[model samples]
Target: MAIPGAVGASIVDYTTGFPVATTGAAPNNDHEAAAAGTADVVQAATSRSLYVSAVPHDLLEDLIITTAGGYHLLRPVQTDFDSRLVLYVWLDRAQGNLAVARLRMQKLADELIAT
Candidate 1:
């Protein structure tokens, strides 16, 4: 929750649709459901051709879903060994800067994979 306006955060395994770790209040106070939902969204995003980049061989990096009250950010964790993890964050729109939060998440995601 160090990111500004972040209310909740989780590291989810998209391959298994499971939460590896979580913090703060989850949507509906259920972290498992949240993780599964996140996995579904990420899966849809990565699979749909509409979301693909024009550049050849391009891959999905992140996804942002905005609601009236908050923003849900999803960053795929790319590792040399595997690319099945995602970092998810829930940020209050009123208190969050989308660009900044995005950058922070990118950095955190990089650090996560570095180790």
Candidate 2:
């Protein structure tokens, strides 16, 4: 399924803000992606007005993001990651949400198998 206005998408490790894997977006080297994701998380982690808070380091796992032009939706996906990592998604602010986007990502993640 195609999400409208979905320009860029990637799975970033919260520990470092890097891409575990990416699609529908420009290619990012693992180190660069990790750094970017980490930076985004750090940027958000310090904000008091964010709709949601970062997972505690002890609880950090996977994360997700969905955004458009006006909103950026983010969520942690490692409820089961044993506090090690997370998936961070970045969406265009105009087309993202805090609740629904992650559910969709969760659905997709559920279908993927670890090799």
Candidate 3:
């Protein structure tokens, strides 16, 4: 939530590559596509981690994708309900602070577990 120039945010199911909840704006206003695409990104990162570490349970805490125009922060949310959930935030790089966004995303993940 502290992410500056945030265009949108969503809670997605990585297993199904589908969005469970979404807020704010999405590129082209296409939340579904964004969710699915981002989920693929998460899946790829996880696969790479597994290949290198040889541990399927070795999960990535967060992944940052920096584009020419903005930053995409993907944070995995592990809760009692499900571990396949992820939080995605799209931020304008010119205005966004990566460190602050990461901290906020961690905090949000904690709060999500409490609920």
Best by lDDT: 1
Residue-level lDDT of model 2, residues 1-115, one tens digit each, is 3333344555556555665666654324354554475547655654453433444444323334333343333345443445323343445556655455556656655444342
Off by over 4 Å in 1: none
| Model 3, residue 66: C-alpha shift (Å) | 0.3
In candidate 3, where is summed lDDT lowest over 10 consecutive residues? 50-59
Q: List the residue pairs that clash in candidate 1.
A: none
Q: For residues 1-115, what per-residue lDDT tens digits would candidate 1 score against the true structure? A: 6699999999999977899989997889999999999999988877675576567888888899999999999999888885599999999989999999999999999987777
Ranking by TM-score: 1, 3, 2
What is candidate 3's local distance difference test score?
A: 0.84
Off by over 4 Å in 3: 48-58
Model 1 global lDDT (CA atoms, 0 to 1): 0.90
The C-alpha TM-scores of every prediction are 0.92, 0.47, 0.87
